[model samples]
Target chain A: KDDTKKEIMKYYWTSLHTTLANYPSLPTLHERNTLYHYVISSASLFPCGDCSIVSQKLMRKYPPQIGSRKSALTWGCKIHRKFNEEFNLTVPTCDDIAASYIIGS
Target chain B: KDDTKKEIMKYYWTSLHTTLANYPSLPTLHERNTLYHYVISSASLFPCGDCSIVSQKLMRKYPPQIGSRKSALTWGCKIHRKFNEEFNLTVPTCDDIAASYIIGS
Candidate 1:
């Protein structure tokens, strides 16, 4: 059960990174707004209470970047780093984030 | 790369399953609306186009069941079975779905 729980967390974050990295180029303002809300809603609904609270606080401070796909990806990486630090984990560099999340791009 | 891609997909669905299985009891209408929109937005922004299209179609046809967390979980399992059948994969039974996704309850 612990392993499954860990796997779910791993998948959730990786899928989130994949989503942020793959937003369409030249997205409309409405689409960007949708993505922003999606992120907020996701954090609000995270299964873990402490993780949810930390995500909410981070979101309150940083907000969602809606400028472009690149901007969203960068913002996502920075937020992920903040989250990592909350767990006292070593943060991945920006380049490593890009290399890992940006597929075939 | 293929393996990583597969891993991402695996996690994505599992995380989604986890989310649906764990929605708060006595959720407000607003919270339910947010969850419904989250599912729709997630399907639209899925990394793969074909997967996105199929998810969209499934949502359009089936919509979301927000009566309770149990309802959401059951709907999620049915939809996942549909997705599985798309690739000619074996569908997990509803009992298996409950066993897999329902955590500590």
Candidate 2:
């Protein structure tokens, strides 16, 4: 269950970053807030209770940094690493995370 | 890009359904709302603009039906099929959806 939740989180966050990159311009306020809610609500809805607890704590601590695509992607990668640390899982470097989600140049 | 968006949507929605099935009890109002936002914001954040437009229309037509796990799963499946139909993709039956996400049962 923990591993499954982790996989879901990885996919969802990667998708978010890739989506941000796919857009031609900076996200509008509405889009930024929508992305914020996606991360927060997804954390809250994590199936693993322990993982959700950790996620919620991290949500409060780091929050979501949203604005341009690159900023959002960077923020997501950083937070994902934080979650990895919290779970004691193998942590990916920021460069690796960014590379994994690259949609365009 | 369209195919990538479709695959992301498929993974995210199926994850939601599977997570619902993993939970032992009905979700609280907070949890339900969280799940709803996850779906909405995900649609809003879809990489493909055309897909996002179609997803928003679907959101308006079918607001999330939240209460129990099974209900949420059913609603997600129905909406996903609606999306499939809208996109002219292969549509999975509701039964097939439930079967795919089955946890304990």
Candidate 3:
């Protein structure tokens, strides 16, 4: 079961990576960081902070570090569970972004 | 007091209008609408659904309709206040997006 979840995170990240690859100038890390902070500062955004929807997508497709591979999955789970407090929406974990959803294109 | 609030909404719309001027290919209403629905399905996103962060930003800058100018202000507030349940974040009314935050970039 966990393996399936991890696989999904992978796909999600992969898709994000593909989308961002087209952009010649990736927003600076600072800009991204600022944006992330802005989104997460709010309770809704913050719960999803540990893992950004975009970051999870980016990492699975193009991991900056090997360690991120697992972090993507793990961190994503944390955010999903956190947000599920009320809405019961399926939380997006890092792995869900990477391999599963990020499937090439 | 209401006038001040309305003025603030006006400024927000203006800022959104400015940012949109740069987008050569604006996302179609359908596409934008899809994305908006995706984000808002959850309670967090929905509260902000009445006023999409990007839409509020877009409308204030480039209006498809004059009627939307006012909708931007009203809807934004509904979403902002809705999310304040656990996270006392300032509600982002439509006006916040159009005239205030949308100030020319």
Off by over 4 Å in 2: A1-6, A22-25, A101-105, B1-6, B22-25, B99-105
Model 3: lDDT of residue B95: 51
The local distance difference test score of model 1 is: 0.77
Q: How accurate is candidate 2 locally (lDDT)?
A: 0.71
Error of 2 at B93 (Å): 1.2
Better of 1 and 3 by TM-score: 1
Worst window of 10 by summed lDDT in candidate 3 chain B: B38-47
lDDT of 3 by residue, A1-105 (tens): 444333333333332232222212444454344333322322222112223444344434443321232333344345444533333546655555444333232
lDDT of 3 by residue, B1-105 (tens): 444333333333232233232222444554344323322322222112333354444434443331232443344344344433224446555555444443232
Best by lDDT: 1
Please give each candidate's TM-score.
0.87, 0.83, 0.24
Better of 2 and 3 by TM-score: 2
Worst 10 residues of 1 chain B by lDDT: B3-12
Using DockQ, rank the candidates from best to worst.
1, 2, 3
Candidate 2 lDDT tens digits, A1-105: 555665666655556566656543577878778878987887777656776788789879988777776776677777778888987888998777767754433
